[model samples]
Target chain A: MNRRLIQWIAVALGAAIVLHVAIVWAIPRVIMSVAMKRIGGEGSVNAFMHTPRTTHEFRAVVRPSPDLAYSICVLDLSDGPVVIEVPASDPYTSLALYSAITDNYFVRNNRQDGGLAEGETIRIVVAAPGAMPADVPEGYEAVTAPTEKGLALVRRVIENDEAMPRLDALRKFSVCARAS
Target chain B: MNRYLYWASALVAGAALAAVSIAWAMTALQGEYRSGPWYTSAVFGSVDADMYTRARVAMFGLLALDRRETMYYTAATDSEGNALSGDCTYRIEGGDLAAHWWSITAYDAASFLIENEQRVYSFSQTTTEREPDGSFVIRVSADPQEKNWLPVKRGESFDMTARFYNPEASIYADPSAAVLPVIVKEGCK
Candidate 1:
């Protein structure tokens, strides 16, 4: 090949590498944004959208485990911090936080919290990086999120068909709201 | 005009190549660990995940937890290196897992639950029946089995995800060392 052809090949290869990196870097952000919008739906930010049991018909997210009942909170810390409260359930339950770029920054389960007694709740204050509210209430754990906007997911294990009613009721009491 | 045409063609060709390369990489790359037919990535949902792992997880498992919270193992092929098909019956055999709780769920090629009449999708540690020796067996096929049946579409491909919630420390140190279930292809329709 001539010098001109070599130059063209170089340009093409360079463009390919740049495009490849750019797309790979953007995938998580774009997908997470779309998920937040879909999960948020008509509800405002900083509140939990208590969804029913995941089934084949549930298309809001892919690869959803049918065994877990999910309640989502689309966290938007652009304004301020948000608070989340989860009611401890009989079976396994967890609250996991994911950044806007899909990194699971924090996770806490019922067992990890020393297996709280009945009628007890797990309260967490999620704020932007270095923006935790000073007035966070007692008994509430405060955490710093890596991004201004992300997702807070609570997963409750559904042992069997018979246990759905009780678990569903327990998940309804889970709350997500602006930190006062 | 000729220079503009050449540049345009080169850029378009480059873009096309990138698209095909990314598509192939997303499907072909199976993380860093492979145990039998099961494979998992430790960096999934962690800040340390690379660009490719992050992109793949975003597409396949949007909100997956970190390895410390949950270790997710997936198998698209059987132990004999055959692609898992809905037409084929597989005997998923395993014993107790080293986790607080574990579950194996079936999904279609598109990573969604395979729609079926019974709406059955997964079997967990608390749900499966055990043998006299304490081991368990699960059947994956289009037809119903006598016990522990996980249904799939008749003429489509599928995959299984084994989730180990709060897995043991040994599992996190080395996932391949964990004794995951085996997917043996029994027969096909």
Candidate 2:
């Protein structure tokens, strides 16, 4: 009877550990999936969608940056490489990519020195490994995304209340599109 | 029959425990690794992070760069260690922080930006009006004040997060030495 009791206790303890781990692992993925779908709609496609500007009240996402004029694109690399471009942004501008499952693929912000080109206009290509076009011009940057579907967001800091109109003009003209 | 009943009950209890513990861990992880009112972790947004830390950050929001490139600090309480309420007026005062750029932003209990008229959600290094010594104090409350005012509502509790992008190397070497703002509660309704 003692042996049987020990076995039952051990089995229960083991089961708890496994279930605990699975739930922890799955929470982020579930939240990210719901977020991506809500923002980009269903399926994989790349379009430069703009976040609302000239507002301080936070929306659904926790910890949204109040300083940035955000532009997002749903990156679906299965269609081909996506090309992203920004107007001459201050040192605060950054481009970040998150996989559909919440893995960070790449981030290139104005802060980096040599890895990125310095100037008013910034351009980069997002493609799977070994998929970069050979004919692309020199000085163009490349970011290898590990997954076929991802989120690419651009942050343009609104330095002050007066800077909004200029930022809006810049973001409205920014491009996130499939490379020909 | 006794042995079978015991085994079944154990399995059911184990599953229940798993669900409860997992939920608690995720919700409470934000409160760890604190310095004063700021809750932060040195390992955030790094590819080299362990599995559990990565999961916690991802549950909030994932970052492509590591903390060296950008660090995040969140505050939910005041200097006196009281929870920040929308009804209270407070002052966020500090000297020059050791970072290239920084901003303090506000969010309500649900993590959404608080609704206000001035349309001010954050005060950054550049926009905040400063004193003669270059130090600054920002007024935070439902009513508007003179300079560097960050408005909140009257009935909601708020969480403020401060972002330090490209922080000085000294911060990574010894986080204790960093200069942080103090949230002093003035009064409340």
Candidate 3:
């Protein structure tokens, strides 16, 4: 047999491997992009899109929790900083911020007086680091997202079936709007 | 010129082969060893994670909390080192359910919940029928059982994930010593 066939086989294997790595690396980016489009494509920069109900059979997203009620927001900082507000509730409240590449860089929970606001509302400004406009309004604290494109997620733990109403009320506090 | 082109092609191919293999190994070996019966990693979704850990977690989903928040442990094989098969039946018997909230969820090889007539995907602490000693046994099979049965469809392989919310510190410190459930193979059709 000629040596060309063996060489070609090795070359093909190498090419396949390269393609595999590229796909693996790009999977997270592509998934996040798709998620952003699905959750916020029609809404403006500050609109909050709440997931109706989470189930084990949620095929659009992978490995979602049946224990938590989630609300999603797409942050587009190129337009301006978005003000994220949530009402304090019992049990617990937490917000996780994911970058374009899906890195959860910032997570603030109700503990440490972090998300704890009692009956009042908790307000935070999500903006790109050092890109926050100086004229932004007062009383809205700023937390920087590592990327211009990011996802803001608020998760509320459901104790059981009876807790759905209370959980629904708590999840309603999650809203976003462009800050002038 | 033709010989030079051949050598260049081989170089690019070799690089691709190495890169792809490393990616597969990362998914295979990265977070699969964080526990005894579970493969939960503290590094998932953390901002402080290294480059590789971040890549692996994002490959699956964008949402995960720190270990103090939630711990997701997945098992693809039984304790005896057999790839979980939907063609077989397995009995998962455990002692007291050990976490603030604990659940055992069944996912197909593609990572989706297995479908059945009941449309059930998991059994948790608050729902499972317990024995007199408070121990619980969950039967996993393609066929239906009378009680404490979790359906696993046939024709495709599957895996199970044991999720613990705020688990005991010891379970995280030394999971091998933790009282994980026993997965005993029962019968196959």
Candidate 4:
């Protein structure tokens, strides 16, 4: 090829690499921003929004499992720390924390650590990196979040239709609030 | 003027190429592990996930847990390597899974549940009926089946996702060795 054409080819190749990296790096953050806004809805930051069972009509999230009931907390640690409390239930239950970049940093399930007994609760304090408070209260496990803004999701398995009412009641008791 | 025109054309072509290539990569590239028609990635929701994996998961799974908490396997083809179509019927057979809870859900090309009159989108371990040997069979088709029927829209393509919650260590070590369901195409209209 001619020298001028070679120069053009090199310019195009450089542009392609730059654009590729920029898009790839931005996808997760952009998608998570949209998701946090949609999931957070009218609820204030660090508060739980108990969603109904997943079904065909549910469009907030892709690949939602119809068998599980979801309660979402859009965490914003800009103030300080957030507290997540999951009530004990008979069915399978789990609390998962995701960073703003969409990485699941921490997960605690009902079956883990010999499982939570009835009337017990899983309490977690989520704080920004290097912002953990000294007074986390008793029985509350503290975790450092990778980002100031993140998400905490609770999933409760719905065994059957008849169990929906009871399970829904139990899941409603779950709490997400700003740590005082 | 000629130099300016050349640079502008070259830059536009480069950006266009990037967009097309990224779209192709997201759709064509499956995860790192493959078993029959299903595939999964060990770093799905891990902090170690690369940019491409994170981008793909953002588009497809969004907020997925790591493999230890939940293993997600997806299949868009049959055992014979044919694309799963709503025009066709498939028989999905499997035995027990190594997770505390498991379910198989169907999603459209956009990864949303397939709409149907029955409002049924998945068959879980707690819901599926098993044979005397404890093995189970599920039917995937537009038409209704007497038992274990997963619906799809006619003339559209779909995919199936099998989620294993709290999977055993054996599955995490070797996902390909896990006893995932077999998707065999039965017939087509």
Report per-candidate DockQ: 0.76, 0.53, 0.33, 0.79
Steric clash pairs (candidate 2): A58-B113, A88-A120
Candidate 1, residues A104-149, lDDT tens digits: the string is: 9888888874686544688999999889988888988999999999
Q: What docking grade applies to model 3?
A: acceptable
Model 2: per-residue lDDT, tens digit, B1-189?
A: 787788888888789888887777767655445667877777765556555676777666554346676677788899778999999999999976678788898887877777777778889988899999999999999988999999998998998988877789987666655668999999988
Better of 3 and 4 by TM-score: 4
Q: Tell me the spans in candidate 1 whose CA falls farther than 4 Å from its real position.
A: none
Query: Compared with the true structure, what per-residue lDDT tens digits does model 4 show for residues B128-165?
Result: 98988999999999998878999999999999999998
Candidate models: Cα lDDT each: 0.88, 0.76, 0.72, 0.89
Q: Identify the candidate with maximal DockQ.
A: 4
The better candidate by TM-score, 1 or 4, is 4
Q: In model 3, what are the clashing residue pairs, if there are any?
A: none
Q: Which candidate is the best by lDDT?
A: 4
lDDT of 1: 0.88
- Candidate 2 per-residue lDDT, tens place, A99-176, comes to 765666677677677533334667788887678777665656888887787788787777777877777776676778
Model 3 error, position A116 (Å): 5.0
- Candidate 4 residue runs with Cα over 4 Å from true position: none
- Lowest summed lDDT across 10 adjacent residues in model 3 chain B is found at B29-38
TM-score of chain A of each: 0.95, 0.83, 0.81, 0.96
Instruction: Give each prediction's root-mean-square deviation over alpha carbons.
Output: 1.5, 3.0, 4.3, 1.4
Residue B92 in candidate 2, Cα distance off native in Å: 1.0
